[model samples]
Target: MRQLVTVSCVLLLAVSGFAQEDSSQPRPFVEIAEQDVKPSVQAIAPIDDTNVFFLNKRGQAGVAKFSPGLSLIGWELYSKVKLNSLNSLGMGPNYSLVTASPIEITQAFDTAGDGSLDFFQGLVRDWQGRDNGVRITAGPVADSNGRLLFALSPFSIEEGQPPLARLVAWHPDSEGLQTVTESQLLISSFSVGPDSLLAARLSMPAYTEGYYISLTGLPSFLADSPDAVPDPLPKTLPSLLIPAELTGGKEPTQMCFFGENNQTKLVLTCPESNQLIEIVPEKSGSQWQGAILLRSQTPSSIESVVEMNSGLLLGGGPDGFFPLEIPAEAFRIESVNIAKDGIVLNFSEEVDRFQGVKPDSYTVKAVSLRGDNKTLMVEPVIESDGKTVILKTSEIGKGVVLRVVCQNLPSADGDALFNKTVFYTIHES
Candidate 1:
């Protein structure tokens, strides 16, 4: 028999007094402040607007609450696990932290349930039954329906045996765990979309291509029987394959569902390609298209990306952590003024020093009366704020057309410049 699950909605306040001022800037270098835990943090999860949970590589978890001023109100050790890998974290009702380890999934509740949660492991040992190769990579996503779902795959594949990718669901009401769907392809990530639809990333072994599948009729798959496995894939289920080129030639390592109903979109993080791709419904609201929204350079790899407020918090191999304002657009030339000594150029945002502030990084050309382009010698001086620059050159004559070509300029968050050329026409002066 199928059990009905009730979804709960909670209202959370927007964090106030946490917005950074224009005068302040994100630190360029990684620093270990006194407030940070001694060991390095491998993953982070927000329990709420004020409380955050962090886990290290060694499985040590800590919880800290922040004040309105962004100061640490309190810090304490949460738990220590036996596993070395912490796959992902999700927040449940009543400040519960649902942690997905390599072997099992556990949820730690702030309030004790029958005085056993304080020592409760919540580990289901018999689920995999001593199969060390079986691992849970993607999730333990606590959907609004009060059920936890995750993607599981085997590490070691045996000959003649198909690689099994299973979507398992655990229902708190029924206290039952069952496999929702099984596939021959590898399922790396999964997320619950609108109307209880399931979206997943599917890849094949040794294949450079992958796809995104949207499974409908998810409510019919939840079961009370522990051994219930759907036979031969449901024909009624609708599956969509996102184009390989749209995925940037790599499988998505992470995925999340964003936006409200009818406007919801799927956001994917492709680590190998260092890109964030989005899948949204077309104008007709019938088909879907994928687009690359952000791409990191050589030195940086996007390990994790989460959407908060109007921006994305990016953290990865690089030692820096910063926000990437959404709706990524080209940095515009805010203002250009002709000064007594030189020409000043101001950008809409702060620019990095990676070849951007150097004179050799630009080619200044002057157009003569005959419409001939001549390279001009100029000295470039970057302002202290890193957003404005000045170019010192000889006196400008009437009808002189000046063109500046900037190459490989990156922003503070490692976003490359889009516009390469800027033209200025000098009037009589």
Candidate 2:
């Protein structure tokens, strides 16, 4: 298999030279199963290469100790609420030490297969009420060393109330949720990277446009400082930022981080085409200096960044009541497009593996039209270059509608996320 690049593709612009055209070529796409990946999780938290954890919608969480080969050493129910949304989930230092509201906000674990979750814990939650148009949030931050920090927002339920959002360092070796206080501009979307934390705050309000990205509390910046300040130490990374805009004056959807650190990318999708966008870190720094790599109007969106490790992520648009199943920042789909031949599809790190497949992954299928009065149906063969799946059609004919789907294939660990499906039409050139 060829080692592909680390960039994620967006379908906004006309992607040329993607499908190497050949009349009688060796089938470019093939249909095959994937290998078994343990710690079957829809929500993944990566810690180095040895430790990681996964959480499911039912609130079930498990830990994996991997030395390339993972062993499910521990499992538990870390939350009390039903984890219905895939994007409204996250992980921190450890499961037991953090306290997230609604009982099921989010938790974290190690991926390097280490027994210790770096001796830290993470908690996250959003607030909602009938009268109060507010959303409260919180989480924890842990470094390679034994230092731990707590992130909290003191109830944003009412207008005119001071936003008490800040990051505080809590010494587990000491006691209580007290210690150094670190505050910064309120953030709407953020995620911890391999060596730093990536965050974004709306420049104005949700009903408006524009936002800023920044990184806080990285060791590289704190190396020279003798005393750690009581505020978010910003990391200056310019190429890893995004500014969301709603065209035609449409309300912007919320965003959330699908997974903490690296190992997982973000995703967002809608029923309609061209409704989402994905983001990634282009570089590392101390302030908002990154660029939004890919932008589009496709209904499906994926982060242009890929974690060359183990993990998964999922997110989508509002279903009516809530602002989509997941938060806007988590895994928002940046865009979607009908193939030149009119084939619709979905792809992300959230899909699972197959029992009989070489690599644990998902599959896409084509559907029929006229309810049942069908004439011809085509299928897709799935192939990969170690990164994304490449699908080859059986053959195309006139007046045919193909439905492509990414079904959840079972893995050694278990089922991960729901399979996605898209439809396409074929016409004569």
- State the lDDT of candidate 2 residue by residue for 179-219, as single tens digits: 23223344333445545453433223543333344444354
TM-scores for all predictions: 0.53, 0.37
Put down candidate 1 lDDT per residue, 308-364, tens digits, no spaces: 433234333233222333433557444455567666766667777766667887777
lDDT over C-alpha atoms for residue 408 of model 2? 42
Error of 2 at 233 (Å): 6.8
Give the per-residue Cα lDDT of candidate 2 at 77. Answer: 36
Stretches of candidate 2 exceeding 4 Å from the true structure: 1-42, 47-52, 62-99, 102-136, 147-150, 154-162, 176-185, 194-205, 217-241, 245-286, 295-429
Model 1 lDDT on a 0 to 1 scale: 0.53
Each model's lDDT: 0.53, 0.33
**C-alpha positional error of residue 209 in candidate 1 after TM-score superposition, expressed in Å:** 4.5
Q: Which residue pairs of candidate 1 clash?
A: none
